[model samples]
Target: MKQLLTLSIVLTCLIVVAWSVSPGSTNAAPEWQSYAPPHWILGPIQGADGSEKIVLNNLDQITRAKIPITAFHFDAPDWQSCTGNLQFRYSDAVLDQMRARNIRGLFWVVPLIGLNCPEYQVALANNYFVKDAQNNVIVTDNFTGHGSWIDYDNPAAVAYWRSLLDSLRARVGNVLGGFYTDSVRPDKRNGVVAYGEAYALDLLDYTRTYVPDGDVVFKRYGVNTPSDAWLNQYAHVAYVNDLPTNFSGMKTGIERVFATTPLMPLPYNEFSGFAKAAPDSETYIRRMHWGAFQPVMENVPFGKQPWDPSFTPQVMQVYRYYAMLHRELEPYLHSYDQAAFEDQTPIFRDMDASRYSARLGNEFFVQYVTDYTPAVQIKLPPGVWINYWNEAEVFKGNRTIMYRAPLGKEPILIARGAIIPMRVYSNLTGHGTGKSEYALTVNVYPIDHSTFRYHDTTNGWLTFDVKGPTRRVALCTLGNVPSEPIIYRIASIAKKPDTVTEQNGAVGINTAWGTPLPERNNKKAVGRNASGWYYETNANRLWVKISTLGTDCPAP
Candidate 1:
């Protein structure tokens, strides 16, 4: 659309861009805000209502969950009666309503053509479908009534699709944030569009041509052999497999291809309730708590997919909160592909700490965790990690403390000056420990905002926002990485329920969050007579006496 030169080749179904060194207009793509990652990863539709109301209503359930609806394939031969105008697929007004509440739509586009559909026929007449080695049209299904495939290599198809996208813009405008194809099959095999990665390359060009300028993604399962450097040329994100929990495998894949890709933290389904039967509250809390540290995160709700009555007040509150957080972190989610290339970290094994983080195409993500317990140390990207949610600055470090943090007790430590309003997780991976405020025993950091810069991760630059949020000590649940930032939010925490804590802020917890076992916030009570106080049995609050620390009063 910017009139930039795009590389075009036939059979390969590919296209490339030549970044004009000469400064052209610096127009940026749009992004979505206030939405959860996704819920129903993929499945068949029942007698479900695809109506905007039905979907949005159902989406209102998970106060904290953002549902990603994958519309049923329109190319199904017998789906005529069920089919609606493409305009109805993504209604602008409907999206506007959802936006008012902070919900996002993850659109799905399958390239396969339908044989019997007049639309597919029109596509072919306009030279749309992809061709085989022999130049014959390749269709998506074997069903007698389906259309042919849109040649990834077909210039005609690209143009038509691009034109179709214009219609989308005219009809829907700025409602959605991200775009991903159900599959990018040049043919029907569902493999990456091949012949030298033509499939993916062309798709990117297509996105630039039509859809809102933003991240374009794809889905992968099983031994997803990405042409790494090659695929990275196009795809900004990938929804990989839902099995084997290969965090390392995922990490390796990302490093080779898009090292900074944002992997969706979940069981792939994004809708399962694993925390339901978690061993303990700490385990449940840790999952969402830990995920909070990652660059990107997606959580599927139990029944918030395609159909539902409506969002209850509780669910609405949570959804609104997460929506606000998502907006705050919007600028950093530039390359969903580069953020979580593969899954290499072991923290994902806890089922509670499936960490997921992403820059809004914004900044670099750097952090250090002291064992996977309830400790964390992440650095904020240089620039003002604008806290879009509350308004504050993050805390810089070199400090420590001890506190009485019991189960269900999260004493929050907000820097009020770290550049953004930070949200502490009750658990990792979007799950909540049902606790309010995370409590830190000891914390040491530069609690000032004088030195941080804003981060832009996409171009890997340190571009400061001229008119960004200027609020200090903003309380936020999301952030954008800028420089070699560091964090100590979960530096040390309680591991159990009802553990003892000294009045001096030393905590002794015993539960599933048993991390940094060596560097606990509060160790066992010391020196008898007024040594330390204990936590109330079976209660979430901690109880400590001041007389316990003796001359160590004030804990130097």
Candidate 2:
């Protein structure tokens, strides 16, 4: 264990240097931003275990359906041989298709070098395999067959494996977007302590040197342990083990994920059968909604896509709605990313590890934990919060109640004076577009006074302030103000606004009389109430477009 700790320190220092010299190291984007976006950790889409033609068609169906996939990751039986050799049999046509669609390709890889393959003989001749106490080759059970792990501690082994990965990239093109570093702990190999963890670390070093722009997400075991403890500081993302798709497994998995807080900033739970199981549509929808509130979402099922024939119309509606909701929440998600990178704070966490409820420790009072049963209730921390869906449904915090939300509704709570940016669009592809047509709404809920710092690629970091007592709110651009027009939509306002004004970096409005043109295009094909900036008088929610405030009131 002590030797392992020393090796970890040395490797971490080297990796830190490699990370610093990587492509985007000097850029404004956070280091973690290299991976799939916060809301779209797409596809465990290990293509159907058949031929190359079947694999390409599976990917084609997803792209044709207009489903948003950030990256495409395929494991064994898709393109690579089962002997754990580096040989791939896929056509360049599939690579061209993926590139044309702007999707990243990720291949699954492990440290285990196949014992039966020709590479094993080469490794043995080169003395690159991990050896047992008797100095014989160490073989272990793997996905396809028995294999020996590359002795990462040996310089020759490291050079050989790194060359192999580089050779794979040469054959596969640069489409290889990093790897899924699988299984950190070896299957009880002697004469080596924590060799699996060391091997995974070296693999990451190779990825950083080769594909600096790509990402690496690991599985369980090695990370968070004492010998491999730096994972807490460097691991950008990780996921819970494959739990059963049933409710009990999901509940247990979610609880386990919550416990990984602050240590791992962006961890997710993998629930099986989301797309294929139509009978659990309701449960699936609820889980989907809950997933959006997570730090990162990975909802790929083994069978069909959610929008495919397997799902009912209603199921599709709910699934797509949450998917859109996830995209819409990107701006808010980045703040947490900034926090994790800059301050080592986990944004998606329970109030405490003991609690099951997940909380976004942002400026907003967002919590995503409540039972699905009728008359279900949730206890919250002390504060005043407004329901994000209805704005009228106000709740004083620190209590439980007979609050039963309707199906398909997630309990999104916003603090009274909180300000959250909204980038609204019809489809998933519109996320991070910064397009003018994508209505950017600044949602200010009922509050006294609050201030939030929001960051984006377009806007480096800006401060939004709300002075509730004086009925004044303003946006201060700490960096550059983005191109998207800022639309201030204040809810819980008592009276209507007669006029709107923009001054001192703040937009003021008396009433939303003739502002915020009714959405020119109705793009609610997903069945969500995609109402673009409307007010509910009885509900006391006033939504006035800030863009119209500075200019002539647009015709609705």
Candidate 3:
């Protein structure tokens, strides 16, 4: 027994040391690659119908309701003057409105030119499209009518495509966030499947120049095949193919998210599905919960608005709760995204093949229930896990347990000794805009020695260190002190500490659990310039407010 225990300790130490020296540990991602928009991207397309009015009204409604959204994705007629024409229809003023709300605009575009589009003749005359064996333009019939696929392999064709996109930029000005490169598949009649990959890759590479830091392309994963691994570099964000609005579709979407994360780190599906009929309230809420935890949370209103009167109020309430939660977790999500880009690690790590669950980096383990039955069996990883919804309810790891997941709640387990960096939820405004200052809240679950390399949007990177022994716990921050204040909430501490000390040798007194620290000149003013700690008896959590106005804590 002693030998096994010593071996385990050595293994744990090695793992910690490895993490401390990993690439993500030493350097922040490049400035351009580190840019992350609000995760809750709203795609307001009701079936095949969408208009500029619909797009603007959806943004207005979401803003009026105080729902969080940072980007609005325009599908079909919203951006196309004639279907498949690479034409910009919405006026620049519409983009101005979006920019005023701090919301970016993503327009749907395709490589095909419909027969009725004026540009079709131009493309055909110039041999810009693929030709059959007889050297005739290969016109294929699709849902949008007959069109010819652009021969992206041809240099002239690619230049013509670039010119069209340039026109869009000139028309829309700078508010264009990116393009949704859908329908890039070439018709089989042309006998060239390789052209589709070129189309997606070239388009993404060129369009990335428009928004150098923002997500430049949202494409379908594996349009060619699952093994087309080269697509990952250009697919800033990828979604599964359109699915039915049913439980089966929900299950398939979850499976695809798990299956594709290895190749495409940022994978998500339309919330509540996008095909067939509208989703029922149960399916919608359940799927929304799953979407909330994914690396990217997107909602496409296929049949009815989430606030429609047909569904129960609980549906909208749950949607609001998860949306707000997703916005608050941007810091946590972006940090892992940086690690994925730098280390090639998946943002959502699959836990079990047979179950619908994944670990969001080392911080969170989430189990998504895909069926009507609320009961679920989950086998946790080795360590202590805390129920995210109810921190008071704890579970021992390396064991299987049947958990009851009632509506509006899913199983989200926070690993013991994990540090999550998040922004204050209440500070968010309409269109998911927030204050300019970097007021952060760090949630720490201290068990043993743990470290988290946290990445912020404005501030580059910071490391959080925590050491929790039998009766003592110490938390400190290292690297790049944030310009704003930080509040640290340390969870799972069973008893009040005898005394808490900061790096400056000032002792922190235990205060009421919910007491708010006073602020002087927008900075936390603890008792006599010494920070303070609070203990919550019910959850066994401690709260500490450290003001990093002009100084940061020394390394622990």
Top candidate by TM-score: 3
- The local distance difference test score of each candidate is 0.32, 0.55, 0.64
lDDT score for residue 285 of model 2 = 64
- Estimate, for each residue in 439-536, the C-alpha lDDT of model 2 and write its tens digit: 56566764455666776656466666665433443333334454555655566667644444444235544422332234322223211222333344
Give one clash count per candidate, in the order shown. 134, 8, 0
Model 2 spans > 4 angstroms off: 1-58, 171-174, 184-186, 189-193, 221-228, 273-279, 302-312, 349-355, 363-372, 427-441, 469-473, 483-489, 493-496, 511-556
Q: Which should have the higher lDDT, number 1 or number 2?
A: 2
Supply the TM-score for candidate 3.
0.82
Quote the lDDT for 182 in model 3.
59
TM-score of each: 0.46, 0.77, 0.82
Q: Which digits, one per residue and each the tens of the lDDT, describe model 1 over residues 405-518?
A: 222222233332222212223333221121212211111122321122322333242321111121111111113322221111221112233333322212223322211112
Runs in model 1 deviating more than 4 A are 1-49, 59-86, 90-93, 99-105, 131-136, 142-147, 186-192, 209-213, 220-226, 242-291, 300-444, 447-451, 456-556
Model 3 has an lDDT value of 0.64
Query: On residues 456-531, what C-alpha lDDT tens digit does candidate 3 reach at each position?
Result: 5577677777765455655666676665566676776688665555543211333212223333222123212434
lDDT sort, best first: 3, 2, 1
- Two-way TM-score contest, 1 vs 3, winner: 3
